[model samples]
Target chain A: MHTATHSGALMAETTSTKDAEFGAWMTARQPALLRTAYLLTGDHHSAEDLVQTTLAKVYLSWDKVQKREVIDGYARRVLVNENNSVWRRAWKRRELVSDQLPERTGRHDSYDEGGSADLWAHVATLPRKQRAVIVLRYYEELSEAETAEVLGISVGTVKSQASRALATLRATAHDRLGLGEEER
Target chain B: MNHDHDDLAAQLGRQMRHEVEGLDRAPLSLADVKGRATRIRRRRAALTGAGTAAVLAIVVPMAMLAGQFTNAGDDVGPATDPPSVSPGPTEPPDQGPVVGVGESLDTADLPIGDVPAVTWLENGSVLHTADGENIRLEGTYEDVVRYDDGWLGIGGGLAVLLDADGAETGESWVTARNLATGQGGDVVLFVADGELRLHDNVDGETTVLRDGMPDTAEMIGVDDEDTAAYNLVGPQGEPFAALNRDGEETIPDPGTDAYVLNDVTEAGWVSAITQLMDDGTCSRTVAPNGDVAGETCELMFDRFSPDQRHVIAGPAYADGYGAGQLAVLPVDFTDGDDPVLELLQSGARDATLMSWGWEDDDHILVVTATPVDGSTDMTWQLVRIGLDGTVENAATPVRGDEFAFPFALTS
Candidate 1:
């Protein structure tokens, strides 16, 4: 208990030293940030990448964060940028592999025990933007504006992405997933 | 009654979250990354060891050459004369005072919106959505960008950027009642349309940023005196390609353009631009390296999700959250297996979707057609996809007429 208390102080000291505002900025925001990143990337690794990148970026701007408000907005923006860069590389790699000879499906998740195996199976099925939007808006409970901040977009854009994402999830829930029968 | 749909959705969220992996830094310390960053110190470290020596050898000549050119590349500070690329249309100097000169307003009764309509006005001026009757904000708003609230009692974790008279700031509208009580310190108003919009926060009155940038009002992060803003691209209404302050239609340089901004993580402002282009269906054109879509690579995704998942859509990362979901889709095994988003929820459907309608909160109106036999078109037969993460072949697909679209609900 003493160690916990001390480490809590240490953690605060470290983050505060890194960016005095960061301790105040993301006091209890790690878990939530992780969740938001997870939803956006659909992969835990990618989500963590986003969160860490955000933290690092926040560290650099510790002063502005404390002097001005909206430190959270700044951090969220960094996370969104990191996530986008990831898929940009992915899309680029996909382009390079577009010409590769087709290989038979050998690693389908139907047999994988990893819960994420199935979760990602569904997430991958979503368009990248909607998936990111969904995680920020619904899971993290950020409003359209906040989501936009993390993602660096307009409120209108948030509404549009959410609408599109909702529709797709709804449809997939109904037909492919047969969600209606379960609710009965 | 099976509550499997809710169970599955919740489970998926939980499991997927639990399964996430963090960035493997291996053996680096937080101190290490910091040390590395400190070593680089931006432009100072940009000059490489070899490049530094090479420049040293030619430093005398380069300095003389630099004198000829207006320090195009100065001591890593803002250059006096940046290399000009394609020039854009130039407008006359902004013809207005940068700040309000003792202008006053009695915001106590500024016709602000009441509860659940127009949100309270920030700085005791302007009406927010809390009181707006059907999204009413009078005349031309030069620009707008949204911000995520770190739970600061702003608008649902985010604040809408304010652009009027050429000034830029971010604050959410409050209800009439909340405005009276005050949100925080001096309302810490920012610049709007070249005017000062102040706010009161825990701290006393603070003038955030002044005369920030012209025609380039955006969500700017300030460091010391260096502040970079992500320019809002693709002006709405008229489609005249905006020129930067220099009146250059094309981007000043590759980095300034707002295309594929989401793709560049180093630049912190990409998320803001991402949302601007992410206006539901507004498409953005930018390269992965965060270059202008026009020059580097013209790749863009929907500003919003395109009612279906099959089409190659990028993550709406640079924008906000609250949109996107999981759906059970019939595995498409065709020539170009683009999985069409079937109806599971009305919210997810694009306004243009015909085969989908809403059934309830979690489910939507679905139209299935005999599993789309070879060469057959997807017809209107509504079905349900559950959230249980279970898939069972439909016994019989339903008809489209049994559905209802709120008419107001369109992609």
Candidate 2:
């Protein structure tokens, strides 16, 4: 009886210690994860929800993620995969909010403060896969190979998607935002 | 890269950084995440335990029956003595009168056969068989529907046309939202830039079907006759169904109550649903000319049978998640005769009918999960129920969670 009690207490102490370490790691990584998730979802509520789900998944496999350096990569993969699933299921819960179609306008018409918001809005309009590539390559600053690995696609796909997305953005910037005159 | 491209890439990175500069704090705490993890772990454990229990539930009974047969022979004679065979029963044990209509079989004695249809996702790819040929799609498609001689793979803001052998036919479309296909898969109807358009796969011609459609208009189903059905929000935000024949659209009024269009038949007949009471909804069939052809109360129909002669339906609401009573009703029924042909196999008081699809004209394929001894875990099996009330197993019973079954059994 005494041995059983001692073993139970030791197990509890070990679990508590492991949890504290995990908590500390999560605290440090939470801000960056939130930012990445926001860029992926293009909305604040969805980004938070995505992060929460991703963190829970990461915690489930915490023991397997042994190396600290590889943690970010592991979490990013989970985040991107989860977002893919979300987009797939989004149609089921879609609600028709308006009876009239919103009129299309140049991106710069609303955002005169700078062209950043316009560029962001245009980024949001890209296909989901292309958007992910741009976010990883330009925002996350991941290399082409790294972006491909994260998205489970070939490096060639990464390069092409990035190229197509950049071309669209460049054209939009020139046509709508009236910037990049030197390149022209 | 050129200097111009390099400058733009840098600028993009800067804009992204600026986008999230204000979100300084995370919304979730470590404790919150851990709590969610704990719940997920508990649920998985419960499911695993239930699976084990379901396996035992089947195995133990079979073992007992086998033991009974062995003992019966042993009781007839000693090892060295001449064995005197006892006469078998003259007639099979009388199972009470078969329930419902047609014929019935013991659920335990269902015959296993090849699955009629199968599709699944594997490692970011979609794989399915077309005409006994294995077809693989490596593109990022969220879903694919078998159409005409090929498949329509939709996702990543594009709809790809693949041949029967899964090769791209070099035809694709940029899809925004609300896409549907005809019963024969020959034509694709989609809403893009507030315009409803139809693409004829046969002629490879794209033409505008309707313009100035509300953003909320969703293409539900298109018939081989080129008639399309869609759901849209009314001026008061009430949901209503509309049909577009050729280039003209009409909002069919079955009555004062609004009905949501569920499906459209190849002949342009529509199956719709409307709330009849607080307890359940009612299903009705409407003709292409907006005439009320038939109606059945309390049951909501899902899809027409393969031959379009019958429809599979269920109660307006299931008692539990995936747990419900399913019935088959003839599409054409007179006022005096009974229409509901209750499926005896799905009459299980504790089983969950997870998913179902039409196997053929006469059989409906159902994936059923029976709870293991009142626990959360369940034993899964593929069952086929015939319109004549015959029930059989289409595959062996599997003991696991939903992940154990790889095929997209639900149509």
TM-score of each: 0.31, 0.46
DockQ metric for all predictions: 0.05, 0.19
The list of candidate 1 runs beyond 4 A from truth reads: A1-32, A67-70, A86-120, A173-184, B1-28, B35-411
TM-score of chain A of 1: 0.62
RMSD of 1: 25.5
TM-score of 2: 0.46
> Which predicted model would earn the best DockQ?
2
**What's the CA RMSD for each of the models?**
25.5, 19.1
Give the Cα error of residue A148 in candidate 2, in Å. Answer: 40
lDDT (C-alpha) at residue A85 in model 1: 51
Candidate 1 lDDT (Cα, 0 to 1): 0.33
Instruction: Point out the worst 10-residue segment of candidate 1 chain B by lDDT.
Output: B175-184
Residue B259 local lDDT, model 2:
52
